[model samples]
Each structure stands twice: as C-alpha cells, then as structure tokens.
Target: MSYGDHGRPVFSSDPFGTVPPGGGFFTPGPPPGYPPQPPPQSGSVNLFATLSVIFAFICAPAGAVLGHLALSRIKRTGERGRTRALVGITVSYLIIVLAVVALLVWLLRPTHTSASVGSSGRSPTSSSTPVDAALLDGTELTRVLNQPFETNAGSSQRGGVYGLREFGTSDERTEKCVGVLHPAASVTYRDSSMRTFAYQQWSRPTGDYAGAVISVDEAVVAFANPEDAQKLLARATEEWKQCNSQRVLASWGTDGKFDSWTIRDVDTTDSIVTATVGYTDAGSGTIRMPTSRALALKGNNVVDVGVVMFRDPTKSADPETSGIDVARAILDKIA
Candidate 1:
C-alpha cells in the first residue's frame, strides 16, 4: 500500500497486519522480549535415570548411587527424568530400613526351649571328677578348693573361685569363656590390694601366669605343649639352687626402701620348684617377714602358689606344704 501528496509514496511497514518498532519488514522474525531459539537438543532419554529406577528394585545401593548421578547431570546438562531419580532414592531408603529391621529381629530372636536342672540346681552337663576345660566352672572350682587352705598352717575356709563375675555362684561360664590353648604373653595383673608378683619374678616367661586366677586361687601359665613345660621346669629347678644361698635387694612398695631379701631353700620335686624369701631389716639385723613362693610344671601348664606370712618367721611348720597342696589342686582341676 502507498499514500502521496507530491508523488512521495509511503510503503506499508506491517509484516502481516502488525509492525514492530524496527518497521520495514515483510516476514516476521523473533517476537519482542523473546530470545532467539537455540538448536534442538537430542530427544534421547537419560540412561542414568532409566538405570536408576530399574536398579532400585534389583539393588537398592546401586539404584541410590545412580539416582544421585542422574540428579547431578540434570542440573549441569539439563537432562530430564527428575521424577525417576526421586522414586529410586525413596525406594532405596525404604529397602535399607527394612533390611536393618530384619537383622534386629534375627539377632534378638528368643530360644524356644530350656535345659534340664538337677537336684543340686546344676545342669545335667555337670561333671564330678576329672573335670576337663569344658567342665571347669564355679562348682568344679569349689570342689577343688573346698579343702582347708594349708598355706595358713591353720585351716582357713577355701572360698569360691577368685575373680568370677559373681564370686559364690555356680555356672559353666569359664568353660565357654576361657580359651583352652595357652596365651602368647606374660599375664601379670594387680589384685584388689594393688599388689602383684610381676616384680618378684626373676625373669619374664614366654607365656601368661596370671589370667588363670580368674577360675582358681593359683596363678597358672600354659605352655605350648608338655615338652616346653618340662624344659621350663628343669631350668627353674636349677635356678632355685643358685638363688637359695644369695641375697637379692627387692623393693615393691612406695616406701623406697629395698629389703635385703634372702631366698631360703624349701623344697624341689620332679615337677615343682618351691622356696621362701625372708626379708631382713638392715637396722636390726633380724628377719622381718617371709614370703613363700611355689612353682609346679604339670603337662602343658605351670602353676604358681605363693603365700605371704608377715606375722611370724620362726614358726616350725613347713610353709612349703601349703604351696604344694595348692599346686596339686590346680593340677587336679585342669587334668
């Protein structure tokens, strides 16, 4: 279209019926306030999101991992399938909770039956004589130590097993708890009085000598086998003779005064090495206190039976016999 007064023609500015501010146009370009269109992206589906939903049912952990990756890709490269990733994550969490609950139920399940109790309130599994490691318990220990404690020279009531969780009860707790095989290292522990024979020992042994006190009065150390036991027994017996006539300075308390202790020969058997250590006061030149120490090597085991006698030093009674009795009791139980 055109309009004129002096042959000046005005051309139509509209593309169709509307004209943009730029005016002169026949074909329409992009609309106002709208950016130019970008090239079309591939219409292919996101493989990660597809795999995430599929794996969520088969393997929850794999599904959760894939879902996380899918979400990251959607943010960076503008992929689709946000819904699929979310569904996988939700299902994975539910599966995890269900698995944990199943484990708890399996672990805390109750026993359906009870064992028979005898007249002594002991189980039918109890053994009366020659108790093995499987039969070592409070009742068995009580039977072993029930006799008089000869170390005192006067009859003292032999108490129940030492250091058992409950002192006076009867159970097969040790039979199940303690390992039958020997421990690999020295096993020294402090008593309620905060005292130990760790300092009194001449040399540290290859095996532990203290943990057995949990089941018996004697401190027993286990050897690898009977041959090792015999070798230790022979060496210890030889040392007893040399150590008997010598005076060694031994200090254990916080007083910082070491006593000139003399080891007196008591007795030595084919299986035992026993002696008494007498402490002499430097100021008075008299015997103050004496402590008896005993060691017996049985098959695959070494027993330590010690007695501390501070009230008397000149008592005619043989303190060695007490130690012997203790050693014998230990062997009887473990035999």
Candidate 2:
C-alpha cells in the first residue's frame, strides 16, 4: 500500500521492475532493440578510409606505409576502402623510385673532346718541315733598294708568286716575300711664281722611314730620321753589294733620272716593305717627288714589318714633317 516508504515493487501486479507503460523512461516497443538481429557489434570507423586520406596528403614512404597498414586491416576486417588505400600506396612508391633513378644518371657525364691524333703516333708538328733560316737573311730580299731585299713570307698576301732570283729557299726554308716598286712619274704644273715646274712622284716609300712595322710573319722594322735613315740604307746597300758587286742589287740614279733608282734582286715572293711619307708643298711649286715605300719582311715563320709616312702639305720644312722627307731620302739612297 505504501510503496514509497517500504521496499516493494512499484506495481504489485508486475513481476519484473519496469517503468509504468506510459512513464517518461519508457519508449516505443522494448527500447528499440536492433531489429531482433544479433545485437549490432560496435561498428568500427574504416581504417582503410583513414589511410586513404592520409596517403593522399602525405605521399611517399609515410603515405605508402600507412596505406599498407590500412590494406591489411581492410583484409582482416573487411573494410570498405581497401581499393583506395592500395591505389595511393602504389602511386606514391612509383613516384619516389623514378625520382631517385633520374638524379643518379644526371650526376655522371664527360665534357670535352680530346685532340685528334695522327696515324704516325708522333705530335703532328714533329713531322712538319722546319722553317729555313736563310729565308730570313737579307740574301733573299728583293733588290728594290741598293741592297738585297726579302719580303716577309708570313706577311705576304696569300697566293703570291715569286721568282727564284727574287728569294732564296733551302730544303728546310721557304722565302715567300714580295713587294712593288713603282717608279716616279712626272707631272707638269705651274707654281705660284707662274713658272712651269715638273713634279716627280714615286708611288711607294723608297727608304727606311718612321712609322709602324707590321708583322710579315712577325718581323719588325724601326725607322729613324734622315741621319739614321741614311745610315740604315747605306748598310743595307753595302750588304747587297757584298752579295754581288757587278749586279749591285741596289743603285742610285740608274733609271734615267737624277733622283731615279732601281732595286735589283727583289724577291717578288716575299711580302714588300711599306712606308708612309709626309711632306708639305713648298712655295706652291711643282716638284719631283718619290712616293712612300712599303716593305715587308718574313723569316723564321715570322712576318712583321711595315712602314708608313705622312706628308703635311701645310708644313714644308718642319723636322716633324721632315720624318717623311727623311724616309724619302733614305729611299733615294738605297735606290
């Protein structure tokens, strides 16, 4: 009767303790039992699904390992995402292996070609002929001046031809020097004094003059003033005379004019010597003049010598301009 005060079932008629048919704890039909099937085993989150997510983000070994673990769990537990995990692991492993092999190949290749060898086994130069020393000697020079003249073989223009008398060559040597000797030509003109004058002009420098000495093969010639030019020309002439006194490779005033001369025994094969001459027109008078001479020398496989002269028409007698005059004088002496 007094259920609240004594230990007794709330409902006397009911055998087991239960909420009254419509009590707050009571719900529809037997607390919604799991459809009369074995009580649903606690469902697990798919490990393979988790692995697939991790593999997609991390990639490579870490992703690969996690994917493998997930696959095993999927096989054991029959997980729903086994296929996804397997794909991720396979892709990540393939990418890593390919990258490593590419890196190794790039690190090892050679960079330049070795020089070619000849059949003889010796250095190519050893088999080449030696340069002749006499080719460099004055004996091979062209007889453009009062001395024997030799052009620079190395400096001469390519495909140039020369006569034996113009240059000398030995079994070991070859003289390939050449030059042109243009004689003076007379030009008739009137001077400021209204007097008819005849001017003679040589096309090239005739003597040792001051200017640059370019390489034939690689010879160099230094020029000086009248005093020095005269001396050098004299020495050159003497050298020529020694070779042949009767023939006198160089001589003065032999070409039918007081200032005219001839160069003998010139080696047309050698490079010619070239020089520039500078001169001023004096008193506005027509005068006979020689052109600047250019000479080139080649020997010992070296061609290096050239001369240029600049003539100042404004300054007739200045020593500064006299350098060209001096050069012309030297040319005259040698001629």
- Scored by TM-score, the top model is 1
Model 1, 1-335: lDDT tens per residue?
55568878666655355545675665657989997664344455567888888888899899999989988877666667778888888888788789899988866643211222222343223122221232223443334434222121221222212321211102232221111111111211112111111111111122432211211234554444444444555555565665565555544345665546556764676456677655667777555545456776554555665544443434322445545655676666664
Candidate 1 CA-lDDT value: 0.48
Deviating ranges (above 4 Å) for candidate 1: 1-217, 253-256, 311-317
Off by over 4 Å in 2: 1-58, 109-335
lDDT of model 1, residue 243: 58
* TM-score, cand. 2 vs. native: 0.21
RMSD of each: 18.3, 24.2
Error at 60, model 1, angstroms? 48
Q: Write the per-residue lDDT of candidate 2 for residues 7-34, one digit (tens) a residue.
A: 7735543345555656445434544655
> Candidate 2, 180: how far from true, in Å?
30
Where is the poorest 10-residue window by lDDT in model 1? 176-185
Worst 10 residues of 2 by lDDT: 183-192
TM-score per prediction, in order, is: 0.36, 0.21
